[model samples]
Target chain A: MNAGHRSESVPNASRLRIAVLAGGVGGAKFVRGLRQVAPEATISVITNTGDDLWLAGVRVCPDLDSIMYALAGVNDAERGWGRAGESERVSAELAAYGAGWPWFTLGDLDLGTHLARTSWLREGATLTEATARLAARWDLGVSLLPMSDDPVETHVVTEQGTMHFEEWWVRHRAALPALAFEQVGADRARPTPSVLGALASADAVLLAPSNPVVSIGTILGVPGLRDAVVSSSARIVGVSPIIGGAAVRGMAAQCLAAVDVDVSAAAVARHYGARVDGGLLDGWLVDTVDSAVVPELDSEGMRAVARPLYLSSLEQSAAIARDALAVALG
Target chain B: MNAGHRSESVPNASRLRIAVLAGGVGGAKFVRGLRQVAPEATISVITNTGDDLWLAGVRVCPDLDSIMYALAGVNDAERGWGRAGESERVSAELAAYGAGWPWFTLGDLDLGTHLARTSWLREGATLTEATARLAARWDLGVSLLPMSDDPVETHVVTEQGTMHFEEWWVRHRAALPALAFEQVGADRARPTPSVLGALASADAVLLAPSNPVVSIGTILGVPGLRDAVVSSSARIVGVSPIIGGAAVRGMAAQCLAAVDVDVSAAAVARHYGARVDGGLLDGWLVDTVDSAVVPELDSEGMRAVARPLYLSSLEQSAAIARDALAVALG
Candidate 1:
């Protein structure tokens, strides 16, 4: 798996054993591009379940669901999140009970996935099994996996009380000034067997355009995973979540600032820092808006490619993916 | 706390310290009636939670919710269950995932109660605390209490296998031939403190027309409670669940048969047996349909009176309560 470019294990190089780390909406959109470009690849999405929480007793895995909905072709295009043809009656009722967590509008249709996952988890099934079950239900061809089966919560430490990632993001609308980020229980949570296998056997690895601090950060925070990826020979490329100076979605800028990192694509690449300084990634995909940072990336001995990353449709996203992969392979 | 049929310690004979042991539909109906007739009475309903189950990770206490909705004046009278203005959108979603049992329709609004209860339970709150929280939300006047805070499931030994009560009632639609009934965990379950206090302090205790085998029997099966009721100084009156040869609601006749009892009002009284015989009841109210059973009840040294037992409406139910209370006082 350690070629520092693309491993030649993918079926015809047309079908790559591609593993992607992702969070919610932006990550999901990038994944949609990945799927469109590499339709024949055995894509394995390692979704961050750090955003997962028991909301009104249902296990709501926001990132996992977003990936699933996107891959299954059922994501709501207009709302930019959740399943298509969704209803929020359950959420409305939940709100009426003064459980007014307004930012995370749990669509009634989306609730089915949550209810199934929660039920199975309660029935002694691990989160891995629950994710598999949900994926099976969606019939999404690609393998979708949670980073771990164990409880690993992302908590944002703010001037206020250290709150859960969901509370920080959804309930508070990510309004609180984040001081730091901690993946609670991640020290004890090992990556699931499939996650390790997917990474090990991958032709290439892509980091979706998710928030670096709480999203992809939580995934990498899993003990031993960073070292495994650092040692792997596969090409590692990440699409920048930051465009110019602002985040594509969520509070990535705030997250970056909380971690004392500059809010720029170059800074994000530097924060990842070649995973032991040239040990994690061979390439980084930055948006056209960050074309100025490409020279700096090359100076750091990492290949940085500028792309028109404003994903307007599946076709545009596929074109971006093709160009990014071509640059990474070269 | 004892007087003739009223307790002097209760301080209000007109405003009775009325304690009721209840289950679902039938019990909830009787509670609605009690609410109407004795609006000023301190009504404490000790509801059976044995019928409670975790469906799709939501804690659904059928008996508790029935009593709650009935007391709140928002029960679906026609279906004899669930909230009056309920919607089954959530259930349809559950069905879509094939997660539902296909028997019970857990309406979205009704599901809010379950979700809240389950969430509370997951947070380490006892069933008693959760029940109090739910009741507080509905602003119910009557003090609704679960029979015990501990886990107690109503299990039915049927020809196929021992199934959960809901599985038996809903999945099979009571079509399976029940061979026996077991109050699982009843041996270890202790009555909630409020239940014991209500029994100890109550002037008159009413066993509403709920199924004796599963409903009232489950409460009686809880180790110390039946003995407490038997020994209490209060007048214990039981309204016949079996009006004639059939139950007014539910398959009470079927339940009685599972416990090897006949399907008559006389049979139901005999099942409660001479606690009525031993002067536990100063009064026994039978439906006019079973006026023939009154002679038998009178011969058993119990004061037997006939009244209309069909709870067709809240007003009619109040009339039944008035007559039953009058019989107890007589």
Candidate 2:
């Protein structure tokens, strides 16, 4: 993927209501930029719960926290996860007690949120309710709705046997060749009312350039979430996490390989397919490095366009957001 | 009361087995000294469980932790509680969420212990079992056993209504004018087998200079605990937290007032009364300033001795421990 920094800043429409599907780092950065460009727009994010897990008697939602911290401006911008100025005293102790993933380090500040959420959950509050209470502490401009209130864990089946997605990603660094990716409880989970409402009432639905096989893929795996996006009156557009023949970030290349898809922008668009041909995408935005496939994607009725997709700064990211909105609103 | 630290350092017998009933700061200090004096003795501390409470979804035993930290050499000596080299970032965040005691702050290093203990308890470990798991992490010289495995909270009844003991002692600084002391659920609680066995087999039993009204009193209130102490053949001795007409530290004077006991060494001894007179104490160690009551206590069939009761230093505390042991062993 070429990390060229070149793009024409486009003017955006005012106050357009939009819903976004997101995962962790990449999604957080994209949404932060999207909010920068459309500061007055009513934004709703449907976060994937597939990465949530019970560790040390506390429920940790990686994607949910990543997005929350990024939006609140308390996120570690350099590290791309957890709160800024965090200490690992509690996590170090937890590891000493052999209670959690040693590799999955949770900073003390992040642990506070987990501990508070666990308290609510233990006292019978659903995931959605607990998240609301946590979100209330921050002035996150957008409403964050989990894809479902129910527990849905993504697992990777490797030759070494199946493990939680975090263990595969964080612990193993996806070194173990995965046989399959399964959203363990997604078959029983339904989209929360807020998620459905966000999709139904939005003018446009955007998918952040997160790993499709695990993040967005896992969110859509929730029983009724994909159907709701497909049925929504909003035009559904996606930004390719991949540029050229590799992932922009994370272990998406390995995930794509495991799922038997070529690590290319074209393969991913076809994976989402065209909404006109009974798939998810109405428009697909690819980075300029992968512009050669734009016409083929357009000819396939997907209405593809290419632009510089490097999120090197807030301004650059906002420019990409403007282009996505322009194409969706066109 | 006696500013002069005048006491003969009595030689302790090697490996004398003893059991101690203790509470927070005073108890922790005394135990640390006791371990120093009798380095090879089998010491088991039956910590007051009434100070235990559920805070932010985690079961926190202040007494157990205090003793454990003290014995492990990790206790904060300056403030007399929590760990040394602590941080409060997580605690500040928890307060922002409105989830825990705003006044009683838990340091991040201490929070690590709480989180691990909570994990064990949630996984079906009994309070006793959870405590054992925590104790295993430290090289604590003495065994810190909770008085009982049940949820026995000490609540203070006041004009402002009833509140947890920590709220009264820590938050309000015991200023609410407590009407009565309550050991809630102690009636349904049974001391663990370890606690009973420790008392049954010990060469002597000790009441640390913790607040008699709430600390030692709460342990004695546990169902069958007082009976075990009285029935044990071991000579039971008590070191007065009260000296002259004042408590050594803490809000013991307020607690003593709540229990209608005059804040004097003689008064607390009378409150426990003489074991021969169907009460708990067989021997009592009062400060040299309160030596005037010794003859009267001796005549009442309870051996009374006076020593410097202030635990101002490790050497001073060890001298007090040696004096208490001498009186019991006589």
Candidate 3:
């Protein structure tokens, strides 16, 4: 095992409930590690819905699906997202009909999840309820909860015009320098009851290494979600998505730059700010390569820890999870 | 060739303007033959949209697609419908998600047509406009017009409950004894300007060998369509779907039985009645096997002719079309 400090046999380990704030692939991988390390602990995941959009008349929640598929062990490990053994017949057909973004491909098997979710939503079920129904299909160890039931699409304002976050990310490959990220409907979105309850009663809150600006930031932007994490007695710890001054996966650097934050772990920690200074994070975890900034973070009233944060495998991911929990517990 | 009197070399054959009222498979096959026989003639096909339904949030126009695919030479000859070499990955996924009818198999290529139609409809395009756009993708050689731009669903009232025509036809295989076929929204539906114009200006109007109760019957039920045909100067000729006291394809027998009409050529001719007596048909063409009904039909003010009406091949279908035009002209 690659775990530097094994916490499987730690006292009250089974009863330690952790709530995770996650986005898509990166977040899903981290949550998978957290589940493995704390097998007995009740893990509640609040997923970002800002990336969600309606494609070909079907409601597609990319982040929720990625997390669900990863937890269920059905995710395409090579592609880093979507289901294994997937077919893109539906997506090809949709494109032939000029229905959705021709650049974005939806696998046939993945479309089943979208169709079911859209049907339930059309039948008056909330996003949270539909997610529960979808989760029931697989033995996901974590309780998956959407940040809010209301729609909140992330629109990226570009030099040409405003486009959906998915269009900018998947279509343009995020090459279009985003001027800003507009969380449409986020102002009116209220945190679901389960999300609020999970935050209020959780032992610790761990923010996954997702895009801080679009993923974790969008979740925090939901009405009353960030305030709940701030007011609760639980220690909130966030793992830096940027490692060695570069994003581990996806275009987090572009997103951070759009918000005028330096693409470094220290700058990200400061961006979340210290809980003592009316910010959300009580602790911050960064890669050992950026260990020089630990004292600077501590001086800024935010407890910081440096560790091997590369989640190359399940064991390596579990080791990172252990370090985050240790920081939160301290 | 089974044609009694071939008219391919007849004068004014290329200039013959024919309007056909049609349904799905049987009608599409007949139209395919008509196009082959009179390549230069202007053939206007008014397709029934009664069998159309919204499946998985996509508007599926079964009859229109059947005709389009057949005329484009992409139809599965063996299945008598849908695109050849098509996959059902999308349909299988939809079923797995419990989104659409599990029993009804929608081929991937067929779903492309539905997606296109639905997308266009959602973007403020009428069904007529969408059909025109879809038809532009294929050199169908004939103009395809929907009976009405408005929605008109065929519902079957069975002993159990009133169900959509697709549910009765596809799911139950039409085994359930239907009390009546309700053309929902037909009363409010008006024939498109093209439909009325085609009927008014046509030299000959032919009724294809489609389902009488649901196909031709439903089209006639559209508020002004039957009236337009009735008031037109064109000679109306109908080719019987029934031969040797049974329907050649589909569940036309069940539909006829439900409407209290005997499953025979003579009975169907009577069902349409004579145009002179305020009915839809001026000429009724039946198979030679049902020759005994000719005198009875003639006595009933309908000019009836007995010939080979089976369309087993393009040559045979063209022969059938020739007979229909001859009857209209006689």
Best by DockQ: 2
Categorize the docking of model 3.
acceptable
Per-residue alpha-carbon lDDT of model 1 for A188-235, expressed as tens digits?
Answer: 899989999998988788887888888888888899777666656677
User: How do the predictions measure up, each by TM-score?
Assistant: 0.93, 0.94, 0.95
Model 3 clash pairs are none
Please list all clashing residue pairs in model 1, or write none if there are none.
Answer: A1-A233, A1-A234, A2-A232, A2-A233, A3-A233, A4-A233, B274-B277
Output the better candidate (2/3) by TM-score.
Answer: 3
True contacts kept of each: 0.55, 0.66, 0.41
Model 2: per-residue Cα lDDT over B1-330, one tens digit each: 122323342344445788999998899989877877777678899999798888777777898888888888888989879999988988888888876778978898888788888888888988888888888888877888999988899999999999999999888888999999998998899989999999999999999999898889999998899999998999999999999899889988998898889999999999999999998899999999999999999999889999899999988988888878887887
Q: Ten consecutive residues with minimal summed lDDT in candidate 3 chain A?
A: A1-10
Worst 10 residues of 2 chain A by lDDT: A1-10
Q: Which candidate comes out best when scored by TM-score?
A: 3
Write down the DockQ of candidate 2: 0.63
lDDT of each: 0.80, 0.86, 0.88
lDDT of 3 by residue, A167-278 (tens): 9999999999999999999888999999999999899999999999999999999988989888778899999999999999999999999999999999999899999999
Residue B190 C-alpha lDDT in model 2: 93
Q: What is the TM-score of candidate 3?
A: 0.95
Give the distance in Å from residue A29's predicted Cα in candidate 1 to where it truly belongs. Answer: 0.7
User: Model 1 scores what on Cα lDDT?
Assistant: 0.80
User: Once model 3 is optimally superposed onto the true structure by TM-score, how far is the C-alpha of residue B219 displaced, in angstroms?
Assistant: 1.1
Better of 2 and 3 by lDDT: 3
Q: What would the per-residue lDDT of candidate 1 be over residues B1-330, giving only the tens digit for each residue? A: 112323212224455788888988888888877766666678899988889987888888999999888777778877778887777877876776777576778888788778777877888889888888878767576899899999999999988999999899888989999999888898899998999999988877888989898989899889888887887777788888887788888889789888889988888787786664553566788889789878878888777888888888766777777777666555
Determine which window of 10 residues in candidate 1 chain B has minimal summed lDDT. Answer: B1-10
